[model samples]
Target: MKTKESKKKRTEIQAVDLFCGVGGLTHGLILGGVKVVAGVDLDSICRFPYEANNAAAFIEQDVKTLSGKTVRKLFSERGLKLLAGCAPCQPFSTYSRGGRKSGINEDWELVASFGRLVREVQPDLVTMENVPQVEQHPVFQEFLSDLHGYHVSWSVVECSSIGVPQTRKRLVLFASKFGPEGLSISESNRRKVTVKDAIAHLRPVVAGQADKKDPLHIAPRLSDLNMKRIKASRPGGTWRDWHPSMRAACHRKVSGDTYPSVYGRMEWNQPGPTMTTQCFGYGNGRFGHPEQDRAITLREAAMLQTFPVGYRFLKKDEKAKFSLLGRLIGNAVPVRLGEVIAETLKSHVAFYASAEKRECA
Candidate 1:
């Protein structure tokens, strides 16, 4: 049951967030006027932040146990329930797809299982997001097949096109049971937000000094040698510019040409390279600050993900660890992209609601 405040706040639409990692999608739905009542995730690390920002209860439950009864009670309504989730994508990601397919990665099975929950819960609408590579995976194919009765549509949308400052592409899908017509989202054609627009205001702080206004935005500690490596690498330059002594052994060989993303720096005017889990490392991808000495801070990574600057992911009294929070922010969906998904689905729901009422009368 929802608390009195929650019941009033969420009078618009109700949502149950599955696999809610730090509540990125949930935040987007909230911004779109949906009330997210509960979020389920196996990671305890997500609870603090997920609950702090959204008026939702964070349940640390493995989603395999999820069912309609549990979901219905949490939502406290039978009207147009929304089921949203992003199954862990590490297994179906391009990185894993490029590797040998010998052993089974459990995360691969979770995608289809997410489909099972959708069928069982029978929510009025569904939305999912994953790496672009997932669209080609066999498990995703099966999930689509399972959603056969719904009005379904999907595409590999560029995150930057939707106002995310990072150049990340994700496969987004929407399914609704309200009609026979297929659903499609209008693509945003606006100019992409650049790296400078995302992180330009902060005062320069070398590797260790935390920003006084936002400590969570502090960059990671750098080694003395790596510090020199970053200084040698100009914006948009690679290790090729480094003196012979500074080159890593792998980069010195002909085969090293394959690993071009290493020791790169961002172009101030363009969208940033995708913010991966290791984006806090200056040597990883084009993650170096365009002008600052250190790598982009945790706050900057989240901003590039299109998360608001004041978005809080940790308790005020917590240690405010940089590397740990960087990992979380880097991996989250750009909240704006999530909002796009919600808005698209909302239009579809409105159309169906009108149709259903006409049919009943």
Candidate 2:
């Protein structure tokens, strides 16, 4: 089903990341040797970090309003053009089920729009990463059907299987105008990274306090009652482990018993829980520190997402607001997983280029 254009060999690869939140995918691709020409997103706040960290132009335009012609203009004429689109995954996330209503129709429409650009631009390669629930949506099926001229490969990727220190699972797709024989990312053989491996060396700060040295290491202030609860809480233990007087009124109700992952501390030797948008809040999921009487800091959350320790999420003189930085870190694709995808695409291109050379001889 690959197009005839796929048969040609390329000397390099160039890409543009769509819905690129904070440049996690762009950084990974750059580390894998791809020249990312531009990153497109609607959020203006992302401009500073995306442009500051990566050498690509940040196009602050909605993907729905973007045209294939506009995207093609950004590509270098000499390389294999690639498109990477990771539309907002809330529309199909497991957390969005049961009338949670985190997504809108526009979100679903973005996937179809991504497919439209692929058909119109006819890029040599494409990659998309989203929640696994997206696989069950009609938009996903429609997206797959649109790939008639491209070789496509997709699967649910376990983040821990690829050396990420979290248990996040995502649906990843890789497609090429070349044949589909070699598109899957192989599992990494490296030992699983643990929470201790990530944040153990940071200078310690207590609840309601920031490390004097690192601005991002500030923890949220806990209420007196909440502070007492955390004191009684053990790693991997929930509110159920607390003394009877410390139990919340909701926990006494039968319905609240099922939400045991809340108000729990992370285990040091194990990977941390999935970092969500409210990861900076102690009451959100199991976000409490294993030993400390506070939730992990913004910097700790970013590190758990596999960002480099010194990666700057804010500019000089900018204040580190918890909600702003938390959303940025939580919504980002883990940098390590992005690297895995980039490496897979690089190898796939190499295999086909070698095959084409043998045919020419």
Candidate 3:
């Protein structure tokens, strides 16, 4: 039953993750059977977590300044190579749509810089993930044009459809020197995961308190008035349900009526809202807990992103700092989504290998 091509395809595939924030993608890819040798990011805070969790080297250099030769040298002794770059998505995020700058920002240039490295290294495979709106930018167009040597497949992926317990959408691109037709990720077709499915089991904590057993379960202190407001807030309801005295001045205005997601509690049966850099704050989006009078904790947010409960974001002796931990958890690519990408790539490689063997015979 063993085909020579299938056996050949079993050779190890090694990868380097660019812009690897806290190693979410790296961890998922490893679960999908890729040997991730290293990760690159500019944030010094990520160094400990990235290395500690994945057992991979972390490079603190900015990708814009990173040379392809330097990256290639890192993979000199590896087998098949993969280059994964998930550039920062702030420039194209839906939250900033109305006031979005017309021209390129430093973040946009990082996409181009990632493309330049692809051209330089010409690795066996390449993958990228970012906000879906990025597809509209000329920078994305330029990056695609640079991939003439590889076959590319891209689509806007709905995170919930792929087992993430959040309603987040992102653009994902897969390119390979192998060929075009073999790269699409099949739809997961499973039941969508819900908020209760992800985090309802955690011990409850009140406003401004931490679960004594888990430091990361700490909530930010709330003002007395804010505490009253949260107690009145209903799951899936907006400020419209609040008493006249409790409503913020802006919510009483016509312009603020449309922003209903703010100061709302999540519905346990549905997927949570997209986690953002400020997700730990109760005032940000629908981050308030369905029943508790506080926002979700750092550990709860991480679990929603599909990170393992044991995933170490802070050192053993390090105290959990809200802002830093929030940024890391909120900005992460969900680990389940990364696993999907890796599985797709593995299938693509196997398909091509089988085809090549048939042609030779």
Where is the poorest 10-residue window by lDDT in model 1? 93-102
Whole-model lDDT, candidate 3? 0.85
Worst 10 residues of 2 by lDDT: 91-100
Quote the RMSD, in angstroms, for model 1: 4.8
331: Cα error in model 3, Å: 1.2
Model 1 C-alpha lDDT versus the unseen true structure: 0.77
Better of 1 and 3 by TM-score: 3
Candidate 2 local distance difference test against the native: 0.85
Instruction: Give each prediction's root-mean-square deviation over alpha carbons.
Output: 4.8, 4.3, 3.6
Model 2, runs deviating above 4 Å = 1-9, 91-103
The numbered model that scores best in lDDT is 2
How much is the lDDT of residue 361 in candidate 3?
Answer: 77
Measured against the true structure, the TM-scores of the candidates, in listed sequence, are 0.89, 0.93, 0.93
In model 3, what is the error at residue 211, expressed in angstroms? 1.9
1-361 per-residue lDDT for model 1 (tens digits): 3355543432245788888878888888888767788988877788888888889999987787777678878866534688888877684332233334523456677787788888788887788988788887899888898787888888888888877787888888888777645366566788878988888876777787677777777888888887888888888888888898988899989999987768777888899999887788887778888877788888788888877888888677565676567667766777888787777776766666556557766
